[model samples]
Target: MNKKREIQSSVKDESLIEKRRAQMIRGAVTLFKQKGFHRTTTREIAKAAGFSIGTLYEYIRTKEDVLYLVCDSIYDEVHARLESLDIEKGSLEVLVTALEHYYGLIDDMQDEFVVMYQESKSLPKDALQYVLKKELEMVALFERLLTECRESGELKMTPKEIKLAAHHLFVQGQMWAFRRWALRDFTISEFIQTQTNFLLQGMAGEKISTQGAK
Candidate 1:
């Protein structure tokens, strides 16, 4: 009975520890997003998390470790969302719609997403590389979608062109987050619709009606 009770108590302690760690990560993300990586301190994180500095250190070794934890958490959320998407549907329009949905999701996760986007370089070497690898995987997903669109004759671009196009689209999508100050007046759906229309029009090889196109 004594041994069984000890095991149960350990499990409960571990569970509480994880809960506290999660709280710290959440606080770190908010502070890092607001004040940047170099400016935010462990004391700020601890206070935000309602924990002591010693307690914060129990879960994370350094400020860099907290950055890694915050980045990894955001990456996990993005990866899970992308992985669950059904990419085999409808047409290029459908894919564009899905991309817009992803943009909206990121917008909703602004604090975490912004931290991951702007403070990635603050992570230690290995942690930075790990986060970058996940980012590359996300980019590859867009590349794969473009390749599919090309193979299905939904797009008229060559393989290299398709890759370049995907890169541009990804960059453009990121602008919604990175340039939110400039884009603050636009709704996510409006931005998505306008951007998708521009991309689709370009992909269709339609002639521009601009003054120089005469």
Candidate 2:
């Protein structure tokens, strides 16, 4: 498990800290989507979160801390959604369903996804590394599923190929949010169907339509 980076807080109650931070993340992510991280002020974040500036400062010292918290919350949600998939079964059908769920997640959180993708780089060095590590944890979920498929003879990929394929799968999901202008013509289901077919064809050498999976 990745150790969460300790954010300095004046509050003593752990549950209160979590509760306030969730409010902070919800508020900050919206402002981040509206105004890029550098342009948004800590005062604005506090107001958006329905609290005073002093209350926000009690939870975080710097605006960057809020960004880190937002990024952390986003990854936690993404991991929870992906973790529920039947990756252990390792069939091509299972893999395709996983991709569908992942793409759907990205679609559902497009604003949040765009904010994290664009503003995460503004975090401090340590916070940025923590966020990147969280990203790899997500990729590893896909890697494990792909490895299981290979072990079960459902996918004919070498270990190296599996690693690259997993990274590709992770990035392709991000493309929907990162390049929405280019992909505006494709609906979420269409995007899922098209990408799943492409990925499965390369990994399993069999084309599978995910239209029904949509």
Candidate 3:
């Protein structure tokens, strides 16, 4: 619904664009997650989105546009989930809690995440960069939280370290979905606890555990 998001479509009416795109995105994400972007056709996406093939074409010129839309939607959902956490308190404990919440979301949206990553390469250069920028915004959320901790003197890390640490945490959450074939033996809870423990301890000199803390 955000106009700022870069989505190439022929529809010009903002409200119509939002409504139809919403419908299209809901349907497309399901099909993409289940059948993958390469296997999904525009007709199938239009049917799933409850629109005619003609209507679908009015909005998108290609199936790749649907893939771009799906990737954008996934990023928005993940960022929204992470933003829902209580991050006002920028202590190490609060950061760990946020990480746990984020990891849990990634686990729940495993199929979506997998689809987003696997299909992102199919997007046009501009669309792919848009998605990547959205990813950076999510990373910046953690970077801001880390900055808060530093400003409060509760944690100490260099600027670049903070950036890389935020990036690392995001990657760790993503690993749950992408590496599920090999990580199948571990439950989401186990994965979160183990990862949070390593990240917390590594980020701070203290022995921190978000395992059961949340």
Candidate 4:
């Protein structure tokens, strides 16, 4: 998803660039959580990373580059953890477990999600498009699961319906973050249980009981 993010810098040492960027990203995430990307200055990010402004510029071109780095890192973490699940099983049970696992990850990284939602518009057009493309890949995971369900005759839905179902699954997972403040009384497990039930029943006649899906 972070393909070709060649952030131009005069630094020629690739290893040092990676190390410095990682430090910058960690520091930037903390700062972004406290003061949004819009409010943060390049000097502040440099100070947070324990570097001088000149050193910070060695890895990043501008403050927007750091924002892109932070967002890219978050998505990378999300994708890595999500890919660890038995997603290849392509069953309702697998999908349920994946959803529950993802909900947990989102809850754990709520601050990062909040920052991303509030500041992603600050990303450059190319960076925003890259992020959106990665998101589409995540939604496609659900589409694959639905296709397998259809093949197994566990659900009956048309291609267009399957496409919409994929989108629903992705958006619902995101809604947990987007609406979390308004739904503070709700737990991630409850969100997973209720939303999974809704999707399962809506897609098929049977409600998937993820109680045994753990």
Q: Which candidate is the best by TM-score?
A: 2
Q: Against the hidden reference, what TM-scores do the models get?
A: 0.80, 0.91, 0.81, 0.85
Q: Which digits, one per residue and each the tens of the lDDT, describe model 3 over residues 11-115?
A: 789899878988987888788888888888999999999979999988878888877777776767777777666567677777877887788888877877888
Question: Global CA lDDT of candidate 4, please?
Answer: 0.82
Ranked candidates, highest TM-score first: 2, 4, 3, 1
Candidate 1: which pairs clash?
none
In candidate 2 the C-alpha lDDT for residue 56 amounts to 96
lDDT of 4 by residue, 16-51 (tens): 988999989878878898888878888988998999
Off by over 4 Å in 2: none
Give the winner by lDDT: 2
Cα lDDT, all candidates:
0.71, 0.87, 0.81, 0.82
Structural RMSD, model 4: 2.4
Model 2: weakest 10-residue lDDT segment is 205-214
Could you give me the TM-score of model 2 versus the true structure? 0.91
For every model shown, the clashing-pair count is 0, 0, 0, 0
Candidate 2 vs candidate 3, TM-score winner: 2
